[model samples]
Target: MKTSESLLAELARSGKPIGVGVIGLGAHGSWAERSHLPALRAVPGYELTALSTSSKQSAERSGQVHGVSRTFGTAAELAACDEVHLVVVAVKVPHHRELVRTALNAGKSVLCEWPLGNGLAEAEDMARQAQSSAVPTAVGLQARSHPALAYARHLVADGYVGEVLSATVVGSGGAWGATVGPRDHYVLDAANGATLLTIPFGHALDGLASVLGEPEELRIRTASRRTSAVDSESGRHVPMTAEDQVVASGRLPGGAVACFHYRGGMSRGTNFRWEINGTEGDLVLTAPIGHPQLSPLALEGGRGTSTGLAPLTVPEHYVRVPELDPRADAPAYAVAHAYQQFLRDLREGTSAVPDFAHGAARHRSISAGADRLAEGGRIVGP
Candidate 1:
């Protein structure tokens, strides 16, 4: 296996960029156009080659807007396109399986968004297929790829904080509380499998694990305070079955006590605050609102000799590419980091990129968290 260092040398030695085709580029104002488009254009070792949508007309429109001449009416066509080396699946969680399977069957690499599938079974099935296909794969899990997180991991390893004693995270769930639009109504139904717990909390947990090691076990308490949401598109009340709040406590793999609580909806209070206390010093990551993936995080640290925390800027060396926008907390900004890493991993044959196995690992943890929620906050081992 080539070390990441060797991969860097190899990439520097070769100048060709990886070709990517995005499935479900979405409509004019969707996340694909807003985030992925900008990100693909900004990253150095990537070239956007094709676009795919449900209809030929929509695909042509998106292709023209995005400057992708080769557009496909369906994912199967995109997957079989010779120009595309990597297939990016950004559609709804429910459609991930078929699209990803198509890409894999065509021997194309893929980068799928988080919650890899609608549920554990679906996620596992996808993971299993990805393994059998033997193609390089990546999950969105962009939070883990953030530069701030990269810096924190280095700091923790270097003992900026002597030994981690405990950590706590409190965050909000954005507009998932009481009101939602027709477009977002699907998320409110627990059966859809894209709920507050699965998306936001799951991403947050992965981010935490990226900085602090994964928790070996956890005990959880999950609840829903709102029984209904006003559908802004229909102007009617819709019954909601998804959870709006989750609280859990556990032990990190490194033996630090970890506590996490996520509340539904937007809040004026401390919307996102994560603190890690150590024997000698402490590190805190905070944001103005929830959705860590979309919120810029500021890192602060303090030691016993200091009266208060001080801003800690992430060193430029932690980032894979200096071309990436380090300022924005938006998806486009953060996701570029993972894209660069995926390209590097693809070129170098390294396992640094989070693949299907990694996604399945996270799914197991999430499934256990759900079980813990059901069983009255009891610890469950990995």
Candidate 2:
């Protein structure tokens, strides 16, 4: 196996594509088709060398669609293949720990979607494995990759927000978790319930921190206003072990107290907005909803009733985000970009954002909020 730096340098010098294998051909996997595969092809230094799925049908279908030559029935085969230099795990949450372990154990670079694991324990284990193996790894916290959020971070860091008074973020939508259909229905089940908080709020909260810096302490409340009725195909009422709605309060690392509201049970129009108030002025970002796939970005700041300005322009680090078919939003492309950066880091051996350790930290932050909320909203540190 090549060291990350050496691999990154080679990718830089070769000016060609890095061979990659994609594991898990479910909804996220399909995303790999529409987003990752195409983005890899377009990104200049990456290649989709192989594909894998648990069943032959999926492998065959995706292989035909993407023009992939080598296909594997399992991740182990994909990771062990000498033809692939990077392993992308877009599988279900329950399988993340194992698949990541397999790829790293095989001395291959790996990238897995967020929450790292279903809970804190799994995330910790994954972190430990990454540490022991010294393999380049990345998690799917894509919001930080956006230019709007980067501008927000710059403002906050520059004290333009003026000592960070408070921040409130609201993310509520019905169809937010898993899309209705045969596509990865397992995610809605309690066993697959990792998506509950981690999927929706995890991405949002990660963005929250990126804009506001780390949180010194936090408290969270999780409630199941409605139970998930199993889709007839799954044959069981997947207990909603995950919190359908969560509200959290905490202090930012800069000493700013913050309140957050997240709900996965919205049956009507969606509501996604975030506002931060500092001593001197306030900032509000609305629309573009929270999905990163949609590009451009709407920006508004400065005190007292100012309508948001369009094309406010963002930092260079903020990606313009490629367009996806379903037209999900910027978060979608932002996430894919994050994954691509991981691939770049692995192939080129450069340090990427939100590595396993960063992912583990975010997991701890959420876990801390959950635990504290259990105790009547007392502040707790992770």
Candidate 3:
């Protein structure tokens, strides 16, 4: 396999935008249309060249709506297209492995959504494939690219909070609550891999781990508070086998105590709140929603002589992409940043963007916690 440096250099020399072919463009109200499409258009050095859907009709319709001419009904055809240098898998988690494998076999770079696969084995399989292919790969753990969180990571690294002592995170899954929509009912099944534990909690955990590092010792508990959820459109009760509440506490590698609690549905008070305390001071991040990758986060800090926490404005340079409407709060803001960083990584031969391997590592961590919960035991490690 050729080195990524050579591949990226060749692509850069082509003097053309990275052609992106997206799979799984839903009929409407899909994440691809709302986030990926907008982010792709806003970011430089990339173009939405092609798209694929479940059927020819939907593919063509989405192509027309999105102003793309190339459309295919299957991921394999899209991946084989010469105009597509990057293949984006935006479908559900169960289909991620197949689509990503198709792209990898076609020798195209891939950007698959988070929870890289349905579970650890699938994630590891794809990660191994990506490594063997030696192609640039990125996973949609976009929360790490959020400007505020990125800046907060820097602050923590720079010792703004001094010696870290502890951290706490509380968030809401928002969708795994008492109600489910017709389109989202699939997430209620743990076998499908898109659950409260994976989607919202997984994204938030990735963001936190990016800043504070991973835990060394961990204990977890999960519960399905609501046995079933009412389908909002059809008014039918959907059996929900997925856990709605997840709690985990552990010690970070740096010796900081960490605690996390995520529950189904939005809370009346705090939807998302994370606090980091140290010997010198404290830092806090708050968001209106639990998905930090989709929602904007506010950062506040108090250090040294400061007695009260004050809003800490992220430096403008942290957001390298062109400004979108509503700025940091825009749905595509963090995604665009992720794309920008990926572009830089390609051009500069850097591996800053979290890749398939990183996704697999995160899956291992989540699986360990889940296994502990399943075994009804605590996990202690160095």
**TM-scores, each model vs. reference:** 0.91, 0.83, 0.94
**Full-model lDDT for every candidate:** 0.80, 0.68, 0.86
Ten-residue stretch with the least lDDT total in model 3: 373-382
User: Which 10 residues in a row give candidate 2 its minimum summed lDDT?
Assistant: 373-382
Using lDDT as the measure, the top candidate is 3
What would the per-residue lDDT of candidate 3 be over residues 37-109, giving only the tens digit for each residue?
8899888778889999999899999988889999999999999998888899999999999999999998888
TM-score of 3: 0.94
Q: What would the per-residue lDDT of candidate 2 be over residues 1-382, giving only the tens digit for each residue? A: 5674366447646775667888864433465655566556645566778889887677877787668878877888888898777788876788889899899888887778776987888898999989888766778776776667778788778876677789998866333332223564555565663655777677778888778877677887776554444444655444343455678888887577888777764434545678888777777776534433233346678743554433355655555334432234332556556655655555555664688888888898887777423424321110
Give the winner by lDDT: 2 or 3: 3
Prediction 1 TM-score vs. true = 0.91
lDDT of 1 by residue, 1-382 (tens): 6432343335434866667899988667766776778888888877889989989999999888878899999999998887787899988888888899999898877889888988889999999998887667888888877888888888898898899999999999865676786778778888877888888888888888888888877776687677777776777887777888888788997689999889877777889999999999999999877677766788999987997899998887776656656555266767877877776665666666688889988888888866424534322210
Error of 3 at 120 (Å): 0.5
Candidate 2 residue runs with Cα over 4 Å from true position: 1-5, 26-29, 173-184, 229-239, 267-270, 288-297, 303-311, 315-317, 320-332, 339-352, 372-382
